[model samples]
Target: MEQSLYPVEFLHFGIHLKFELTETGIFLKICVVNFSVLGLFFHRPLALNLKAQPGENVTLSCQAPDGVDIEWSRTDLEELQYVFLYRDGHIDSDYQHQSFKNRVELKDKEMKNGNLSVILKNVKEEDSGTYECRFKAAGEGRRKRAFIKTKPISTIQLEVADPDPGELSGCRLNLNSLTGFYFMLEADPEQTLCVD
Candidate 1:
């Protein structure tokens, strides 16, 4: 299935993802030079705004290619912000912040298919801040062994609010990541309202 070069995927986060169909396998080649396209064309804020009530569980989403080391933390909590760290195929608890000692965990411990999202349990008002996920990408081209620390690959502004009387029970949040789209289906025993 050798196909001609063409733009076959959605343009996400200013990065142009070109997927080529070849006999060997479908290859994804990302052009970082076009990072400017995001601001130049969309004129939109990069951080995704999300809201959750205190005591509710929320997931801060992130995605990157496999083989990359990922770090999840609260950008606002500078004093003790290291939320979760995964490297060398295991969680590194040595550097994790005490506040997040037992409150945060990876959605998928295996991280299969590059799902780097973290589930923050028991949300608090103090946790209302910018949650960022960064990845250490392998150096491109000839310097494959070298590591490139990218700018905050994904930033999530989590607003912990207090639910009013008769407030809704569940909410669905959808956002695109550096490498793919992430969506969570909240518990809806009666009916699930699709987020369009």
Candidate 2:
């Protein structure tokens, strides 16, 4: 009599295994290789830069899907500061920082259209920093209940510049000039002279 062997392949949970079957019985060869791991995915965050003058209102835009729990935080600070937090179809102000209190607002009506942006009123020099927008999909569970895992969707770098005095006088000053120029003239004692 003659004996023959056949090769068999099996794949389970991203792991590949091979086996050999003969006329007498079955033989097991443990060959395990993983191509992908469960729950290990990559997500690239979007970058946004914004510049505004002092006392100006700025809106930090974060485009995410509708009905997701969104949170805005200042990551450039010494400690992670919560700017705004929206969850369960409402804004949670208890976790917001004192500096951002009563100054942040969300476009509640626009959330239906996937606009998770927040408006920061009266931007100050202190507000210039890197802000991160994170989102947590509904029904998503983390490995630990104490550790709330969220995914970063967007990052915004804000810059606030002082208002130019010449701009208030309806004069367009060339700010690119490296050399400062001065003008002197004989005027009344009550007159004042200002140099930018």
| Candidate 1 global TM-score | 0.56
Candidate 2: global Cα-lDDT? 0.66
Clashing pairs in 2: none
lDDT score at residue 63, model 2, on the 0-100 scale? 69
Residue-level lDDT tens digits of model 2 in 1-196: 2222211122225566678898988777777766522232234566889888778888888766555667788885434348987766677777578999999998555586668889999999999998888776533443321222454667799998864543442223334356665443323334444455
Find the candidate with the highest lDDT and give its number.
2
Flag regions of model 1 displaced more than 4 Å. 1-46, 79-81, 138-149, 166-196
> What C-alpha RMSD separates each model from the true structure?
16.5, 15.6
- My TM-score estimates for the predictions, one after another, are 0.56, 0.56
Kindly list the per-residue Cα lDDT of model 1 for residues 19-40, writing each as its tens digit. 8899999988665544211211
Task: State the displacement of the C-alpha of residue 157, model 2, in Å, after optimal TM-score superposition.
Answer: 0.4
lDDT (0 to 1) per candidate: 0.66, 0.66
Task: Tell me how far the alpha carbon of residue 31 in candidate 1 is from the true structure, in angstroms, after superposition.
Answer: 34
